[model samples]
Target: MIIVALDPPQNVDVEKWIKIRYDELKEYVQGFKIGVPAIIRVGLEGLSKIFKDYSGLLIADLKLADIGDVMALTASIVGDYGFNAVIAHAFVGYSQAVDELSKTCEKKGLKLILVVSMSHRGSEEFIDKHLESFVEIAKRVGSWGLVAPATRPLIIKRVRELIGSEVKILSPGIGVQGAEPGTAICYGADYEIVGRAITHSENVKQSALKIIENQKQRVAKCRG
Candidate 1:
């Protein structure tokens, strides 16, 4: 499962980025990730314009970090903006926040993907600091999925154990970060979110195909 991160900074040629990647953005990727840059460059209008022709899951990575009511409201607005899913900051908010966001998303049939961990250099300190507690919150809140680094083996196992196959995991840090899709799956990641690895490649299509090919090989190996 692929989740393409559309997170090129503002200076990047958004139109070119979209156009070049258009042909390759097929069912191979389960979702399109709209992070800070994409959201900023192409607001609701841009999103509407893109999704008008492109039909895949849209993930609004707002990473919302507010109270229960605010989180619910933000998620509702994002849903209204035609997003299939939105991200929430699991650490900052309370369980009630998750409940509220989940309820709102459920009403609109949208998904709330909780950011249990991010893929950055200093993430370990922040995540390891409150790993167990946050995992409990994630399980209790009942969001659609959790985002974490694909490289972290133990945390992924713990998360799966807590959720017991109910909650999905969207793991990033593949390719460019040195954790391939096969490696992530072997560690139990449900979906792979890739960005620069494909977007910045010399041949986007071939790059995507290679990653997909690698993923297939890995999945087969894991099953065997």
Candidate 2:
């Protein structure tokens, strides 16, 4: 599945920009990821209006990393805003924060996606060292998915091995971050979170379609 991250330029009208992109690529992609930029610009209500007609997964990339109560409250609000899934940091530990977030997500019927590792080089300094702990937390909490970086396909491969086939993996850092279109999927990611590349393209639909095609070919080759 291809999940588009709606990270448009600051100057553009975020709501309209997102609506246009949603309309263009909604059919080709499986879901849309709304990050801080768009959330700050138009707020949750605007997002609801934009995606009212969208039936696919709507993920709120809040990256929630606060205490249990704080994160739970924030996720409650996200669910109220019509988001079907949320992303939080697993480094927050297994007891209070992640456990609470998982419970709240279950109650709210929202998919809890934990960020196991990041795509940037700096992630190697800290997050990479605790991959096992992160995956364990996801399992303990029964998380719906985990976020790994597509830029590091080996990380995706290793994560798949650790988590196995039950929980899903969503990878970022595709286009602008330099990972090939379907590299993560071939390695085991269930979905690729792409921003910039398709959102910033002159022809959004074509870019999305091309990405889907590339993912299919790569997965076929990997299996064959």
- Please estimate how well model 2 matches the true structure, expressed as its whole-model Cα lDDT: 0.93
Q: In terms of TM-score, how similar is model 2 to the real structure?
A: 0.98
* Residue-level error in angstroms, candidate 1, position 25: 1.6
Q: Which parts of model 1 are misplaced by more than 4 Å?
A: 53-55
TM, every model? 0.91, 0.98
Tens digit of per-residue lDDT, candidate 1, span 40-75: 776776666667666677888888888788988877
lDDT against the true structure, per candidate, is 0.77, 0.93
TM-score of 1: 0.91
Model 2, stretches more than 4 Å misplaced?
Answer: none
What is the lDDT, from 0 to 100, of the residue 59 in candidate 2? Answer: 97
Local accuracy of candidate 2 as per-residue lDDT tens digits, 1-224:
89999988968877889999999988888999999878988999999888887889999999999999899999999899899999999999978889998999999999999999999999999999999999999999999999999999999999999999999999999899999888899899999999988999999999888888888898888889
Clashes of 2: 0
